[model samples]
Target: MDVTIQELKQREAEGKNDYVLLDVREDYERAEFNVGGIHIPLGVLTASFDKLANHKDDEIIVYCRSGKRSGMAQHLLQQSGFTNVRNLEGGMLAYQG
Candidate 1:
């Protein structure tokens, strides 16, 4: 599953923090800029699944450098029993625009 940048922005405008936005990028990538997401690098997501366990089955939006990693993460989360996982389409590059 995926969400457009506009949809995400509208959700933000609605003050909807109900969804968890997970950033699978590296720490350095996050330091440069992010969509106010939790800093969980892709390399650590699986091992640190406990940290995100609470968000499972919730509205979780995963993203990465170019959407590839996040897509993988989304798949992993789904396999791990996360019900409402979505990938941010086009990633931050699209969001920045």
Candidate 2:
């Protein structure tokens, strides 16, 4: 599942922190602009799987510079037994659009 930037904003405005916002972009990209998500670059996602083990059943919203990397992240998490995972439709690009 993919969510729009507006939808994400609405969730945030409503003070909903029930889900995990996973940012899979590179550090530099995140430093440039981000939505305040957990910083885990795509390259090390698998190795850092343990950090997310406790949230396997929680809704996770993955994002990146253009949604590509985060899409891969979403797939990886799903394969790793993550139940509710969603990709930001167009990542930060869409968010900043």
Candidate 3:
């Protein structure tokens, strides 16, 4: 499911730290700006699965520059048994809006 930046902000305000916010963009992209997420570039998601093992069943909010990479990552997570995964509606661009 797609979540708006406003909704994500709300969740953060609520101290919803139970979820894992996965930023699937590249390192340079993250260096520019990010919504305080765990950076794990899309190309390395499968290899970095161990980094997110703790959040297998936990809520995961994935995002990228335009939601493309993150959306794909979300599906991959689901396929790997991630029960709760959400893709930022429009990624950083949407959030910036």
Candidate 4:
């Protein structure tokens, strides 16, 4: 599944954080501008699984600069048994738009 920037922003405006936001961009990319979330770059996401194991059953919204990296991360997490993983549609690009 996927989430649009509008929907995400709406949720934030409502102060609804029932999901886990996972930023899959690199350190420098995040250092530029970010919506804030668990910072686990895609390259090390697999090794960082333990950091997210606790939220395995929770809604996890993965995102990156463009949606590509996060889409890959979403797949990896799902393959690892994450029941609900949603890639942010168009990712940060759309969010920033």
lDDT score at residue 32, model 3, on the 0-100 scale: 87
List of clashing residue pairs for candidate 3: none
What root-mean-square deviation over C-alphas does model 3 reach? 1.1
User: Residues 19-49, candidate 3, lDDT per residue (tens digit)?
Assistant: 7899999989998889886899999999999
lDDT of 2 by residue, 1-97 (tens): 7888899999899998889999999899989998886899999999999999888999999999888999999999999999999999988988999
Residues 36-97, model 4: lDDT tens digits: 98999999999999999999999999999999999999999999999999999998889988
- Sorted by lDDT (best first), the order is 4, 2, 3, 1
Superposition TM-score, candidate 1 onto the true structure: 0.95
Best candidate according to TM-score: 4
lDDT against the true structure, per candidate, is 0.89, 0.92, 0.90, 0.95
RMSD in Å for all candidates: 0.9, 0.7, 1.1, 0.5
Winner on lDDT (1 vs 4): 4
What is the Cα-based lDDT of residue 58 in candidate 2? 91
Q: Quick one: ranking by TM-score, best first?
A: 4, 2, 1, 3
Clashing pairs in 4: none
* Of candidates 3 and 1, the better by lDDT: 3
> Lowest-scoring 10 consecutive residues by lDDT in candidate 2?
30-39
Candidate 3 wrongly placed segments (more than 4 Å): none
Clash pairs for candidate 2:
none
